[model samples]
Target: MTSGFWQKTGKGLAKTRHFLSAGLGSIFKKKREIDQDTFDRLEALLIGADLGVEVTQVLLADLKASVERKEVGNLETLRDKLKTSLIEILKQVPVAPPIDESPIVTLFVGVNGVGKTTTIGKHAKRLCAEGKKVLLAAADTFRAGAGEQLSIWGQRAGAEVIRFPPGADPSAVVFDATSAAMARKVDHLLIDTAGRLQTKHNLMEELKKMTRVISKQIPNAPHEKILVLDATTGQNALSQAEHFQKAIGLTGIVLTKLDGTGRGGIVVPIVQKFSVPIIEIGVGESPEDLIPFDIENFVGALFEEENP
Candidate 1:
């Protein structure tokens, strides 16, 4: 990533950085030594930052073990140990493979208002900018104006959209979109499905049916099933991941609206729990803001001081 992108990531994570610093700086400002009080404060701070109880416990456990072994003696060492632990958890997710297949079909799934459609637009823009012929499948017929919204984004990205009337069966839309993509021989086909709550069984089954339809049309297609999550939703995002992963396996995740939340630590728990690679994150409103997830840059941004 360029330094510009790194700077933007750091800027996007400003709230999270301040949240961490405010909590941690006070604990370590006096060059506090490894002690029970320090550990307790760290545990509370991490959990408050939305790292989730299990992840917080594991991190603290590792830090305590390190201290017991005399590997960590002061505040700086404690910070380094925590940062290393986070990176290790993030590294558990394997890198996503290259899109070798033409008309690479990718399904975007999530609950309503998670920026699922917006993420698709940003992704389409990225692909179009790469000089690839991109097509969008507006398979979200149930939501009012969902097709129109996708059509607007399709225009913005200079990609063709395949949509049907509202209330039409979503699976039918996917089926037709698959046919169009195959006939047009586009480089990428990005599908936008209706954002149904994870708990809705009927809607989830519809999603599965659409998956089957795409697979039948093109073997091993819909090559990517990405779950779009709202970072502001915190632990609720975890619940959605659990249900969606069970309903239809997820190949990747797109974490959006990080700039709006101080609980960006939620990223650590999501990866630790699901082991799904975070493909991209929505740092800002523009299409250019949906940057690819980089482990080192993310960790660095979390701890780096604000630019003067």
Candidate 2:
């Protein structure tokens, strides 16, 4: 069955399109030039667009080369070139594994309050609707009410939730959950991890334990380690990504809160600097609001309305 992202991402698409339109819209305003003024304008626009300094510089350097050769002339060529470059960059992220197999485990990690738990719930619901047997492990045992919240989501999503009392050993919960999943032959096992600062060794240790415990049941069972990030955090998102990746090794990133703020450009720098695959974006709070990251749809959504 088709997912909800393809349907409700229109608003996110619009937000992204609006930003992209503003960025590329200016590039074609005047006759193409190889002068420093042209370079400065483009650079400033991208940086202001929140693409980050490094990404802006790299993109600007490439644009400079094209301008010197007069390869980028008008709006059409500029838009196409931008889209192609972004697509090439995004193509590096492999498509997520299909969920047809049983007992697939996904470990969710990120800093506090990045919507990690909510993302897990949404994912569980989606998998359930697809007719897959899904289970949720509330391994975020350090936080108060985290277990109950996940249990609520379990009921809402119609999936079983395995949780321990607050302050219980998270690894034990995961160990039990994995065993339950295997015994039931479930399709997917999504583990909700604690949201701790990357600097916290104890919390990071907990994550490593979660991974180690899962390995016991299914070798390298946590097939996907998704880092959920707050898009509204902007550049702070990059720092969080760096720390989280270093600590637990992020397999992908889930950018949350894209629907509220205009800071969607965080996607560019996060990918450019870290090379972490952006698997999904949280546009809004609805269970259906999380969208798979699509470069073209994203770029098109960012620039659909305006032209130079």
Candidate 3:
């Protein structure tokens, strides 16, 4: 990632950082001995930041053990321990396997209004910038204007979009797009599916049908099933993940709108629950704002002090 992007990420996480640091900085400022009251405050701070209950407890337990072992003695030490613990939790989700094959097929999935289409556009823009031949499939046929929205994004990203009439079979759209991708021998084929509530049985079945169609054209295709989630939704995002994961089996996650929420710590629980790598994050609206997830940089940004 570029330094500019890194700076933007830090700036985007300002709310979450402030939410965590304000309490933590005060708790550790004097470097006093660790006590139960200190741990209680820490627990509240973590929970308040939307780390989720289980993850918060695990972190607190680790901190308590470290303190008892005399491993954390000062503000800097405590901060370092916290950062390390978070990184460890995030790293549990193994990195996605390399995409080495041509015409790499990826399905972007999520509930309605999670910025799934926008994320596809940003990703397409990134791939196009690398001079790769890219094709976008507008299989989101249920929503009126869904195809048009993907088309707009495809145009902006300098990629071709394959679509059918709204209300057409989304599976048909996927099949044709898969065939076109193979015929054109493009470097990437990104399919955009309708945003359906995870609880919607027929809609979810349609998603599975689309997947089957792609596989018929290209074996083991739809190489990546990515879930785009809104960071601002906090714990609700977890329910979406649970239902979607059971429905389609997520290969990756894209956390969007981090800049709009102080509950960025929600990323930890999502990863812990699903063990799916967070492939990208959106900190702003610009196409360039979608950046790859880097554990070290993310943790650093969370603890990075604000400029005086």
Candidate 4:
């Protein structure tokens, strides 16, 4: 990662960093001894950071038990311990392998307004920059202007976008896009699906249909099913992940809008509950703002530690 990447990540997580430093700084300004009250207050602070009650309790228990064993003595050491614990939880999802297959098919899923289309665009740009011939499938015909939105992004990313008339069958779009990808021998095919509410069973079933279409068109196609989530949504994002997993199993997640929210800690519970590898995080509005999820940079940025 570049130095700018680390700097931007630190800036993106400034809100959460302030939250953590403030809570810990107050508790351990001049360390005397760890006590029951200290533990209780620590639990409250973590819970307030949107770690979720269960996860906070689990982490607090681990840290307190370590203190009993004399593993962590002062605030600075305890801070390091907490950082390590969080990183362990984040590491539950392993790193993804490089895209090696020709015309790799990827499907993007999520509710509306979660930056689903934007994530697709940013990734398409990255792939193109890598000299890959990328094609975008606008399978989001359900929404007005969805096709145009992707077309704009395609122009910016220097990729061709496959689409149909507004309100056309989304399956048809995927089928045609797959055929184009094969005929052109493109390196990657990114399908941008319409945003569907999880509670709407019919809409979710539609997503399943589209998934089937992609697989039928190309064996082992839709090779990647990525769920795009809004970080600012807090626990609501986790609920979205759960509901989408039931509808269409997610292979990974793209967490967006982390630049300005103290709720970035929500990433911990999302990964813990779903075990979904977070592919990347949207830190800002630019195409380059979409940075790959690096555990060290993420933790370091959030805690103001040197990027490892």
Candidate 5:
């Protein structure tokens, strides 16, 4: 990421910065001696952000130990300490390397209203910008307008979209798209699936069947499985991921609406527990708004002054 991209990312994280920094800084605004009261207040703020009680406890324990050791005194110092610890946790998500596979296959999974369809368009735009021959597979045949929505994005991104009618077999769509990708020698194939609840057993079976078609049609295809999550969902996002991971394995996570008022702290527990890298984040409506995830910039933005 360039310096300009970092600046854009910092701006995108403004809401989260305000949420965390403002709350943490207020606990020590008076410069009072750091004590259990400080930790208690900090605990409340972190937990309120839906960081998960267990993870929040771990973070608070570390901070409390630092305070007892006289290493952290004022609120400013405590804030820095928390940021350092958070960086350690945030950096644990494995960075997604550049795509090396020709006709690289990526399957997107998520429930409805997480911007899954829009994300596919953004990704297609990115691939097109990179001069990759891209094709979109709209396998979300169950939903009304899902195919048309993807087609509009495909046109906007300058990528061809292969889709079937509503109620059509999604697996057949994947198989057909895979065949087209092979015949056309495309550089990237982005597969979009129907949005389904995590606990819906029949929908899960449908997803698995789509996965089967990809592997069967193309060798080691569907190289990446990314879950599109709405960061605004907070704790519910974690719950959704648990079932999605169980039903259809996830290789990476793409968080949408980070530009909104979402606490954004939820990313912490998701990565800390699932071990899945946050591959991308959508901050705005434009195709260009879905930017690659940069741990350093994200951590820096999370703790920096909101006005910055």
Candidate 6:
């Protein structure tokens, strides 16, 4: 492993731990005996952490059952149970599909101001370093500076970029990009789509059209529809996820801005509710800040010691 991996992974885990502790702190310090009141308090904390109502109830019941079976006796044992339960829930998420072919089309989507373009740029650079010929598509024509911003990042990553004038049809851009990728024989094509507000039906219709357009040119193109989410927004991000998933099926999620604000607990709910594997995470501003998500590393990092 490289220093970049450990550094970024460490930062992400610290943020996760901060949020998790906030949610479960009270119970973690409670007296030895496990009682109904303690269980009820723990349940409320889990729900408040945005663990989702269904998951909260299920975990609470499991914890009570464990206690009845004499499997848990103190906060230390209960904490282990909590972590184990979280990891088990996350284990059900599917892993990322193997990418061996050239010009693997990846479509990026999320609401505006969630760092979608930045994430694509970072990913493109990483892919290039892995000896892949990467291409970028500026499908986000709605935002005033989306194209120029992504184009600049493309340059930094030494990748080709396809763009059209602002106000051009978003789907049309993707259509042309996929066709170009087929001819150029690139290794990966990262397409950045216009960020649509969850409440806008017409905007969402455009996203569906983009998907349809790419699938037309290359069957099963857009092999990945990655939803980039901002961790700072907490539970509101979940509301957005629901709308986006309903609009376009998401294969996985990429969480951005994972360094602070103490709401990393939102990730728990997203996994439990949507079951979308978090394929990548961004903790800092560097290009190498993006790293593949590892559940064990993530759990360790989030609860790791604070830096000096």
**lDDT by residue for model 3 (1-308), tens:** 77876888898889999888887888877658789888988899999889999999999999889988999877678889999999999988766659788789999999999999999999999999999899999998989999998899999889999999988998899999999999999999999988888889998888888888999888879899999999999899999999889988989999999999888999899999989888889998889889888888898888876563
Query: Can you write out model 1's per-residue Cα lDDT over 164-264, one digit (the tens) per residue?
Result: 99999988999999999999999989999888999999999998899999999899888999999999998999999999999989999999998998888
Cα distance off (Å), candidate 2, residue 165: 1.6
The CA lDDT at 260 in model 2 is: 75
Q: TM-score of each candidate?
A: 0.97, 0.90, 0.96, 0.95, 0.96, 0.91
lDDT score of residue 28 within candidate 5: 72
lDDT of 6 by residue, 164-250 (tens): 999998888998899899999998889998877888999888888999998888787788899999888778888888988898899
Instruction: Arrange candidates by TM-score, descending.
Output: 1, 3, 5, 4, 6, 2
Worst window of 10 by summed lDDT in candidate 6: 299-308
Q: Candidate 4, overall lDDT? A: 0.88
The reply for model 3, stretches above 4 Å from the true place, is: 28-31
- Residue-level lDDT of model 2, residues 1-308, one tens digit each, is 13344445557655656666776566556656447776787677677667788877777777777767888866676666667666666666556566555678999998899999999999888889989899999999989999999999899999999988899999999999999999999888999988888788887877888898898789867888899998877788888888878877888899988887665777888887788789888888989888777776776555555443
lDDT of all predictions: 0.90, 0.80, 0.90, 0.88, 0.86, 0.81
Which structure among the candidates has the greatest TM-score? 1
Backbone collisions counted per model: 0, 4, 0, 0, 0, 4
Q: How much lDDT does candidate 1 score?
A: 0.90
Alpha-carbon shift of residue 144 in model 5 (angstroms): 1.7
The reply for model 4, stretches above 4 Å from the true place, is 305-308
Candidate 6 residue pairs in backbone clash: 13-301, 13-302, 103-186, 103-187
- Sort the predicted structures by lDDT, highest score first: 1, 3, 4, 5, 6, 2
Error of 3 at 30 (Å): 8.6
For candidate 2, the per-residue lDDT at 230 reads 89
Residues 1-308, model 5: lDDT tens digits:
79877877877888878888788778878658877787888899988776788789889888889888999888777778888888898887777677677788999999888999999999999889889899999999988999999999999989999988899999889999999999999998999988888888999898888888888877777889899999888888888889888877899999999999648788889999898989888889988898888887887788887654
Task: Give the higher-lDDT candidate: 1 or 2.
Answer: 1
